[model samples]
Target: MVTVKMLKPYYIKADNDFIRVILAYQYFSVLIDEQVYQFVPTEAKEIRINRRTQKVENMGVRFAFQKGKDIAYLTMSELISLPDFLLQLDTIAQPYYFQEKTNQKNETAIIIRELEQLNLRRLIDKSLDERDADTFHSLTKML
Candidate 1:
């Protein structure tokens, strides 16, 4: 048997957009402007890092889901918080991330580790709009 666990969802304001992120076992989903994008963590690829700005830029990472029918790209320009989020998700999605156990009745089980709640506000920068910042701040506090 396989079981899935998920962390609490958080809201992030990035590049003038509000995104709702839900992290789960093996996968993470994002709600962007009312559209939901679900992706497998292990499938995350096309990573590009910028050392000068210490950020991920120019479509640094791309996640494909639904048999490659859906895709989401993230680029951080001086938005420092995204790397951690991506790293955590990728780690858990790895094949070795899950453990197996056999019980007395010969039932096999798969267990997944719990993920920590992400501080979505950390992705926000001063360049964000004042109103959007206010909204994100309030939303973060409420969560």
Candidate 2:
């Protein structure tokens, strides 16, 4: 199962690709072109997968990378641009540069704080028609 999946490589080739898994959610799935793949992980003491899709053939496998280690993503177009010297890119190790900070951090915090509020006053104020109907009914009713 892929810890963190990328769609770039799979899109480059019509092979079986393992996408991602969520241990906390108890669910894992592989997708190609926005379609779920029915792939089964191989049991060879190594992280492997066999994908089965109609639009594509049943052939795509990605070995496991070291745990907690991340890889850099390269698009097919970018790969073509690399010189022959870069063909042997195995020596380079992709680092987790974003472990420090991400772009959406501040925006996410703002949304979470707004959602955590217990007050529904903002919602009620927005529906003026509903408020007017309730006020008129209360004034006319005896109790």
Candidate 3:
């Protein structure tokens, strides 16, 4: 069995509530109001701040996350609440940088190997089509 390592936990305030985020390799979990929501990296597509009400007395701020087919929103009554909410969102997005870098390297290696195989196959086909016994024998030996 293989053991999986977990990333450090981070906490931030959303209005009167404090949310905790736990990161892992391909996914992350968020705890809000004693409830935990597990989210996949790809599922979280957007994060933004929304303003509600134009009147100065009734203005409110809403921080939201667009996750796959659903949206999770949290509202704040004070403008000072924006910073912490933004910070938490930034923390949630951090692990994807390392994960994407590793994924890109693996994808590039796979593409290169596939291209090499295609070139070899083409060379073998050409040799057979021309009835070149010496070239065909050499190419087959390389395989």
- Number of clashes recorded per candidate: 0, 2, 0
Residue pairs with backbone atoms closer than 3 Å in model 2 (clashes): 16-59, 16-60
The prediction achieving the highest TM-score against the true structure is 3
Give the poorly placed runs of model 1, Cα more than 4 Å off: 1-26, 41-59, 65-68, 76-143
What does candidate 3 score on TM? 0.30
Q: Report how far off residue 126 is in candidate 1 (Å).
A: 31
For residue 112, what is the lDDT in candidate 3? 96
Ranking by TM-score: 3, 1, 2
Better of 1 and 3 by lDDT: 3
Cα displacement (Å) at residue 128, model 1: 38
What shift in Å separates residue 21 of candidate 2 from its native position after superposition? 17
What do the candidate models score in CA lDDT, each in turn?
Answer: 0.37, 0.29, 0.45
Give the lDDT of residue 102 in candidate 3: 56
lDDT score, candidate 1:
0.37
Question: Mind giving the per-residue lDDT tens digits that candidate 2 earns over 44-127?
Answer: 111112222111111232322222243223222332233431232211111211322333556788887777542343444444
Residue-by-residue lDDT tens digits, candidate 3, 33-69: 4444443433322232211211122235343333346
Give the CA lDDT, 0 to 100, for residue 11 in model 3: 35
Cα lDDT tens digits for candidate 1, 11-125: 2222222122333333444454556555455454333333223234444444543324665553332122444555543443322221231132134222211111233444343
Let me know the TM-score candidate 2 reaches against the reference structure.
Answer: 0.20
For lDDT, the strongest prediction is 3
